[model samples]
Target: MRIVFILVLAVGVGLAGFAVSIAKDRFDQYQTALAEQRNAILPTTQVVVVNRQVRYGETLTEDDVSLIRWPAEHVPFGAFTSIEELFPENDELRTVVRIMEQDEPVLLAKVTAPGEDAGVASRLEEGMRALALRVDVSSGVSGFLRPGDRVDIYWTGTGRSGEGVTRLIRANVQLIAVDQIADEQRNNPTIARTITVTARPEDVAALTQAQSTGSLTLALVGVGDITESETVEVSTSELLGDVEIIAEGPEVCTVRNRRGADVIITQVPCVN
Candidate 1:
């Protein structure tokens, strides 16, 4: 019985030692593989990446972003290299101009200036004035108008000669907003009651006068299309070929009295 017990004990000890050796071998292989992976990685740049999903017009903060090691050769233009670069002086007050997804690099063009909110004026170029014009379905291009669209402004009303006329007031006017919204994300078609456009200061007075004296209409132009040629003024005659027919003029006729006045009446060619 003693001999049998010793043999069983020896077998159990051997099996345990074998298991430990296998575990040690696996651990050493794992460590060696991890080291090899680290050595194979290329040098990277610490780039600021969006830590979470960010929507357009939403302000960004430090917590909303994180640093990621991007390959140095593949870094995009204007990519923020560090947290400080993304938020200068640790200021996180920046509005997003475009949507950002998690792990995406943050670029200068994607965010507004520090402490700047995403306002309509922020989208304007230098020396441009944002002018809001009232619009309806017919004038607003039937809700197909959007920010960044260009349009030709047309004024339609009676002229001094009492003839209806349509004049192209402004050409290639940039449309910046529909109603109060200026988001590019809101592209759904809607009948906007007003449209905001950017125009030069010199053209504001003309636009104001056109809106007051005549009905203003918008004709959307093709994207990226600009026509430098001058547009001609149009009237009834220009639209219809050879529309020279004169309207009937009033004629002079003598008054005719009925037979009941003095038992006699004078006819004057049935009053013409």
Candidate 2:
């Protein structure tokens, strides 16, 4: 029994030695491989890991490159150097940069078309094109004419018949985009209200004529109706003339005494 116990103790000692030897061999092999890899690539290239956090809004400039540095341990895995494992000291492996914000300047202009008057111009903005047309704003009739208001266009023309009587030519016109930029006018103290309208090279003359002869009345439409052209055409005659408006008489009256009331006011006033 004493001999058997001694034999078991010797076997245990042998096994422990063998395990230590194996571990030492593996560690040497790993160190040799790492050294070889470092010699092969470390001189020619630099591997750095970032230490800070970067955000999406941050801008990177060429001058910011000096903040990166190499990590402590170097090892080779298949293709890549196993950067994450070997470079445990690196958090971001790059530098966190902050970017500055800037504001870009812009210019806006207001333009008007012929016969297209102020009421129409006010509704216009910077990016619109004007097709000149005549509109009638007799007195203060078409609502309170202002910039940015959308209106339907109506055109009227006079046509001579064979019998020498004048026939009325009437049709609907589209009030394209308003030509003036309200924001620029309101914001800039020096800028006046102008409107932009879309027009062909040829229509400029007809628009000017329409402004002179015909009357354009604004037909206020909903926001959805203001966009896109359904159709456009030249017509003669008046649109607002078709609608009759009643005016109230003066509110206050003056009274005269007998001396002034008996005077004959008409026969003696001829000045040729």
Candidate 3:
């Protein structure tokens, strides 16, 4: 009876140990699955951003920026992922072309190329030229125009028929600067005397001629407005609702008589 009792007790202990081991393995698998699910839900990436407010024409340095973890799926285009990408060379640096607030992402469009200055030339793309136009308060959209805004240019001058005409000279032209101010953050109403724009070679020529021949006015385009403008021209007569009328006279019929050598032509009434 003592021998049988010892074997049963030993078997019972062995079964309890196996059950505990299996439970421990299942708990480990549960922990690993939970970690993988958390990672998938909140994936992130490191992005370089400005630590302090940086203004236009200011040199960007290593100490002025920091890296933060941003959502991998929503990262902005042209955002720098690492410090080395923003500052490629130790000896060279880039200048800010637009104002960047604190903690803002450093974008390629807001900064100049390495060793380049913040100038109008840097803002222009290939095959584009910067052109300046003279403007006053009335013609410059009451000093509410900004650098990044699009505008429609109008020309007011005398027409070939000796009438005053106002026509749309250019549509959807982008303004790069207003009176030497290229910062898009500027909101104060400034009566600018000159505004700079980027245009193709042909447009530059046409704008230059239009500026010299007559007065030019700027019409501000709304943000995200991509509607194409039609050919718009207004004359002084049209503005006053004047219409020209033509009067018709009675029809006259002529009868030709062949006399000896000369033909005689006389007006006669039509029978029909």
Question: lDDT values of the candidates?
Answer: 0.86, 0.38, 0.94
Name the TM-score of candidate 2. Answer: 0.26
Tell me the deviation in Å of residue 80 in model 1.
3.7
Q: What TM-score number comes out for model 1?
A: 0.64
Q: Which candidate is the best by lDDT?
A: 3
In Å, residue 79's CA in model 3 sits off its true spot by 1.9
TM-score of each: 0.64, 0.26, 0.72
Q: So what's the TM-score on candidate 3?
A: 0.72
RMSD to the hidden true structure, all candidates:
10.3, 20.8, 11.4
lDDT comparison, 1 vs 2, better candidate: 1
* Model 3 clash tally, residue pairs: 0
Q: Please give, for residues 1-272, the per-residue lDDT of candidate 2 as tens digits.
A: 99999999999999999999999999999999999998876332233222333232232222322222233243222112234422234332221112112211100111122222334343434554356443333411232333344445444444343221222222223333222333211222222222233444454555556546644444555646635545544322233235566999745544444565584333333344
Candidate 1, residues 1-272, lDDT tens digits: the string is 99999999999999999999999999999999999999999898889999888977899998899888899999999899987777788554899877788999999878888999888867877888989899999988899998778899999999899988998889889877888778767879999999888998989878988999989998889876755638757998778867567889866456656666654444455342
Residue clash pairs of candidate 1: none
Predicted structure 3: lDDT: 0.94
What's the candidate order when arranged by decreasing lDDT?
3, 1, 2
